[model samples]
Target chain A: MPRTRIPVVAGWFTEDTAEEGFRLLGTRCSGCRSVHFPREDDHCRNPGCPGGELEEVALSKRGTVWSCTDGRYRPPPPYVSDPAVPWVPYTLVAVELAAERMVVLGQAAPGVGVGDLPVGSVVEVVPGVLEEDPAADTVHTTWHWRPVAVEALS
Target chain B: MSGDVAVLGAGMHPWGKWGRSFVSYGRAAARAALDDAGIGWPEVGSVVGAQTVRGGYPGYVAGATFARALGWQGARVTSVYAACASGAQAINTARAQILAGMADVVLVVGADAAPKGFFAPAGGDRPDDPDWLRFRVLGATNPAYFGLYARRRMALYGDSPDDFALVKVKNAAAGALNAYARYRTPVTAEEVAASAVVADPLRLLDICATSDGAAALVLCGMDFARRRGVADPVRIRAVSTVTPTFPRTVLDLPDIGTDSAVAVEPSPESFRASIARSAYEEAGIGPEDLSLAEVYDLSTALELEWYEDIGLCGPGEGAKLVREGVTALGGRIPVNASGGLASFGEAVPAQAIAQVCELTWQLRGQAGDRQVPGARVGITANQGLFGHGSAVVAVR
Candidate 1:
């Protein structure tokens, strides 16, 4: 099999992209000026907010880590997890973005455990491997927000 | 509170996976309702169809499809798509047409030929879509969200796994007697525990399955019903289809994040509670006046949550009510008289219409075995993805 880096999905963000900036694309209403993330394909969802055409917008690259948890058990069929090996718990992070006004979810970057990150710490997005199927020669890569070192930043 | 409309006829194509097209199921159910109403197709003033995305491309617009299937009769057609809440929206559309004097008699139909397994959003590489993102990103299935709710309930109310299993036991027993239910076998708590875990804290039995089914109803103006010598037919008093207020707090399905309540105080009532409250206000009835209820029991735990949200019990007292057997048969106020989603599974568009069908049967005293005694007032509550609220209040 040819070697390749299989991305979960294209265009939302890219693997091998620089660490200085990483964020998902969303839409903001021009008329009502309300921001919506994971973008609205149609009109503004805010029913009371008059009329506004949704415009493509960029989201916050970094936010404060709000709370975190771990799914110790395996998920259902749609979620790809190997049964042969013992289940490994992955850390789940919830970050609060001030600009868009929503809590975004993402997996923690590699080597970052729930115990390593404190509440209200700053985290930025970085590409990480979600799952690997060695038998099938597939490595699913997704974007994860890492609690970057404070000293690493200016 | 507004001009009343009479439900002239209601019918179903049963609830099971027969592997037929949604159009076939919808057309058959519509024909059965028309036959029950003793009205010909051409005599029907208008038709509204609630759409099922499981219909593939044809689902994009269902009203026209059903109109063509029933033979083009040049009637006013309206198709509504709101995931699970489509059925209630269809009823609301029909009621609007009748109240407006646009159509004296209207037919509303919802049908689905569902696929097996967890329902997924449209296939695409669209990362911007949250529904697609959750599936593609974290592989979070619907049951995972259900599991979260079950876990949260345990944390908040000290609810045990048996409490969740009891919901299945109660609903399954009721489902056993429902000829329209997909699963006819009554379930045991042991069975629920033994069933494979679809999501943590929730086993296969604790969640509903996807099935193929259809339901249809014929509605007419109150004056028309009285003129037809039908003095006391079941009336749809209120149809609440509201969206979530600005800052939604709950973590809903297909969405990875939640609205930050830092900016504004969250509504005292969640989106689901607002649905029932609006219906009660419009119907001029209180929770104390309700005789029975049919809620969206997509998961057994979610059903308990609805008990509190719909005012069947006080906050966090849902488990207590279930333990006391107040929501069971011969209880104070039996819920899910038609066995709910626990029996019917998720048929999307058809489920909401099915809820009303259950209400109609109870109100008419036609539900022989599952009837709640003297069910003169009933309500159905359900919410669809992306803030589609659905509730209907029916009175005899």
Candidate 2:
């Protein structure tokens, strides 16, 4: 049986391949014009703002790398990784979105390591796998950061 | 200042991976503090406990637990939980009670029996929990954040892994002189280089471990101290428990992203710098007055960050201070004279209290081997999870 792909955490991103797709989702306050990632559905977090309705908005697709690192040891659960198999290190990136003026953390794309993404380098959000549960026949989908090629800038 | 509270006594149970209940450690430390103060537990007017979440329900109401364990005399009890800053918050509560005339003397105790290996969040599949989501979604462990900060320092300040190793070497030398430290043996930079990398740009030796430890203090008003024939005691001048301002630009632990700066411009000073600044303002002192310091060294790189944050040096000069031996013992300003978390792994709630214990001893001229000569004033800086900021200033 083929595994069904689903977001590890729902409503965090879109898997769409179109221009508008594969972007992380956040909430922007109508009154304050401030944005929040991980979707603050309640209200504006800005203390100075009186109050505002939070509207779901897609975050910037591309951002510059603020910092990046790799996890050499296996993180304990609920970060699911089979202990029977040797742990493979994964790169994590903190990208700075200029429009939102916020830094978001995510896993680097498969085959992308810390050496590839230097600080201030451009990276784009891409859909990727968080984990796979064979028993449940499920593929946990999440977001990955991939470094943009320099040639693409021209 | 009228807000001053005297530190009558300070004590601790040595930090290590000791397989013992946190209650036992807390009880022992409490007794030691009572003895140091030359006062019995029954005479205590109030008791404050720093909560340990891993210890079940009893840990939540730690004040009553310790009070009962010490044969409760019906002392007013309080418990505080603020992640790493629990101890400092507990101290703050006790000081408030003393200043309010509710209690002439207050006992502050913190203890923890941590699990082995990496510290994971509580179990459950709660989508709303940011800590859980970060781990499940990105597998970003605590070390990952440390690695990010270390890399940032390297990129921004031209710091190298060797500079990070120097922190461990200097701290380990101090730890050797501390009787309560777990890893007392001095570590060399060569050994640090050989250790496996737990996170990129940080070696195994760079990160702190989890341990079972306890610390306790007895605090009283100045009048009460003079009445007890102690004219001059180590006085806690300030306890800063400030929260972060809006649009927190720096990414902290257990958070996936920083607050948006679109609406409010980000503060020129980082949240950490503010934590120490608030304490200094409250104490009416500055970094120049510090004879010694004990900042949270969860990682070697973090210790350097704290140097800049606590005003021990200017921005991006942490590595230079270490290289010049300015932060080492016998230098301009000694830091982590008790060996820091590098020597004594994190006991969460107990660690911050232990920092104060070191300050108390240093200010009193009681720190034998690791003592800062002519130590008159000392400060401790630590930050808890969420937005809890903690810093304490003590003077002789």
Top model by lDDT, which number?
2
Q: What TM-score, to 2 decimal places, does chain A of model 2 have?
A: 0.95
Question: How far in Å is the alpha carbon of B361 misplaced in model 1?
Answer: 0.7
Tens digits of per-residue lDDT for model 2 on A18-74? 533779999999999999988899878899987879999989999999999999999
**What ranges in model 1 sit over 4 Å off?**
A1-102, A107-127, A131-140, A143-154
Q: List the residue pairs that clash in candidate 2.
A: none
C-alpha RMSD by candidate, in order? 5.0, 1.1
Q: Per-residue CA lDDT of candidate 2, range B114-231, in tens?
A: 9998888888787788778888888888889999999999899999999999999999999999999999999999999999999898999999999999999999999999999999
lDDT of prediction 1 = 0.82
lDDT of 1 by residue, B1-396 (tens): 456789889899988989888899999999988887778899898989998765266786778888899999999999998878999999999999999999989999998887777777776466666777786678666776776677667766888789999999999999998999999999999999999766556788989999989999999998998898899989999999988887776767777777645435668888899999999999999889988999998899999999998898888899998899999988998999899999999888888988998899899999989888899999999988877879999999
